[model samples]
Target: MTAITNKGSGPIIQEIAAVIVENKAYLSEIDGKIGDGDHGVNMAKGFGRASDRISAEDTLTDAMQTLSDVLMAEIGGSMGPLYGMMFSDMADHLEDTDQIDAAVFGAMLRAGLEGVQEIGSASVGDKTLLDTFVPALEAYDSALAGGADFAAALDAMKAAAATGRDSTIDMVAKIGRSARLGERSRGVLDAGATSCCMILTGFADGIKTRLT
Candidate 1:
């Protein structure tokens, strides 16, 4: 009911990992309606392992790399590679920054999206995670361009993500197994986009306490 607040990525990542753990069963229940039903379990296991690997001495890249490694090795199903690619690409782009500003952070998200594009070949409106991710990243960029502060930009990004997630309910799935359902997919929200929004929104909410 309240706004998502965030600070740095470290504690937030840990919180995200925790969220995955807490919601694993619920996520699977949603996925069962339209997907393989293993998405929730895979995501939770991946993030939980990554959390144990993160540390205060670690950088964002380090945290992301740890996430990538865990997901790539341990996570199963299509969601593994897709989520892993995003975090890995984000880490690759962020190697140069110790602390990211709003613009820089937005660009990092762009890099992550590009990774997803490279792997999934899906774009916005295709009813994939990109539907939520691309819009959220773009919203972050737009808000920063409009002279909004970090918190404001993050707020816009989170809002756009929620909207994008909701939009999927009206769209016919254009890729993956759900696409096979044709018009039936129109009324059901995309599990991938919903989960992606949850991750991003969780970061925004958790960072409020950690960022200075």
Candidate 2:
């Protein structure tokens, strides 16, 4: 299959909101194990507000920007600003494009990663969202380098995201509130990583459905 259109796809963004909102309970549950247990609540509130403002006529970039704006402005957690920058950076990379191929997708991913890194000190194996996002991007690049189609590359990304999320279960928290737990944090999954997997997988699946 060819690449998906770069024109804003409102439904895709809506689907992302839906996925986050639907999984609110799960996200908060995980966070309760290592954090303030408000990850899902804040995420649902931010995404829900964005969904309400975004119309079907909005472009994918438009929808992402709206979400970023809300997350950055209204939410009050590390995730709020982190995810706000991520979506904002992703939208920045796609704003002028009309088509998104595998390479374009990779660039967008890299931009989002950089955006998050700019504001956060977490790194790979820190039991943070980077655990999921970094490997997912790497897997996507690897799949494309191996001549895989966009759809196949997305599949590889999703698989790698899940693996990365799971890997966090055994990782000691190296940042954030969970770091206080020290060795105790190793038994449960990182809420940020878990939510990142959901977001990445949801995004890939949503875009795949729009592929030509």
Candidate 3:
């Protein structure tokens, strides 16, 4: 029953932001193949802005709220609104929780996923972020149901996120700007899926290190 405290976990978001900022160029490069080529730039901008506002003593909920605000208001592209709503829903789910155990985290993840699904038209296998996000959540839940601890469930989620991201390589773009490319989009990985993998693995790693 490993859990991480809700208090003073804002730095985890900062670390996640750093990961996004550091990979900005690479993400954009991936997007250049099939999309507008601004995914990384927009992601880095929003996450970095949120990181600067988040303090070390702030709660995870507070940090995520800030991230959601920035992403929704400052970043451009469809992802901004999708990710913004996701984080907002996730933070709202954890607003009153003091400890983040497997069950609690799973609820938060589901909230975020639902937020994304509610506002977006894409579904699983659409070669979108849902490709990575849905599988990761399912894996996390399955691991916990199988009697794995919180940390192990997070590991399962991270692995599934990576596999989902990779699965996009062979998928034809079914939505977004890439959809227009049809068959031409099959060989390249979906940029949204890649970034979604980063975010999920970031959460898993951050929580794993804080588990007690």
Candidate 4:
């Protein structure tokens, strides 16, 4: 297997920051219904820090570790742990190898999702990031199983994650602060799920941009 060089840190942070910045208002709106209404602010603030740190970092794992440190130490609310574990786990998984192939990339995403599940205590269909992440991971694996290339696999995963994020709009909250709203949480999007999709999209876009 040709070891695919990892997407560098700068693009990683930039993509994540761009998505959070672009969706700031929308994320805040979703958080308003079920959370502290500051998901956007807190996320942007944290990713901003991560992006700035990327300039000083040499590897993708370093970027993830830096993001983990910032999120764990500085941010508040449920996101801190959830996203913190995500980057941390991704970094850990990717650190051993100089590059990652499609199968390895699938495992990397699954590790991050597992870490988030560990922290958030949420499962698939919980109307959280798990909703988006789980499907995306599955889609990535399935695409690989179906003999897709890296680019094609990533495309499939992106589509699946976007669908998963959209599915949250009609779902009642089953976990997190949103669960307290009972059925009222329905009809509104899940901010975490939306951000989840954005992350996956950003990741895919970054890789595509680099590979192209």
- Candidate number achieving the greatest TM-score relative to the actual structure: 3
Candidate 1 lDDT over 1-212, as tens digits, reads 21222223555677788888898998887677777788788888899989998876566677888898888888857878888998899888978575666666777788888888898877789888998998898898888889887878889999999999999989888899888888877887788898899888986676544445
- Candidate 4, residues 104-203, lDDT tens digits: the string is 7788888898898787777777789888998888898988899888888889999999999999988888998889888888988899999889989988
lDDT of 3 at 206: 91
TM-score of each: 0.91, 0.98, 0.98, 0.93
1 or 4: which has the higher lDDT?
Answer: 4
Off by over 4 Å in 3: none
Order of candidate numbers by lDDT, starting with the best? 3, 2, 4, 1
Better of 2 and 4 by lDDT: 2
lDDT of 2 by residue, 1-212 (tens): 77877675766878889999998998999999889899999999999899999998778888889999999999969999999999999999998788888898899999999999999999898899999999999999999999999999999999999999999999999999999989999899999998899889988998898899
User: What is candidate 3's CA lDDT for residue 50?
Assistant: 97
| Reference-based TM-score, model 1 | 0.91
Provide the global lDDT of candidate 1 against the true structure. 0.80
> Rank order by TM-score, top first?
3, 2, 4, 1
What is the lDDT of every predicted structure here?
0.80, 0.92, 0.93, 0.82
Residue 170's lDDT in candidate 1: 91
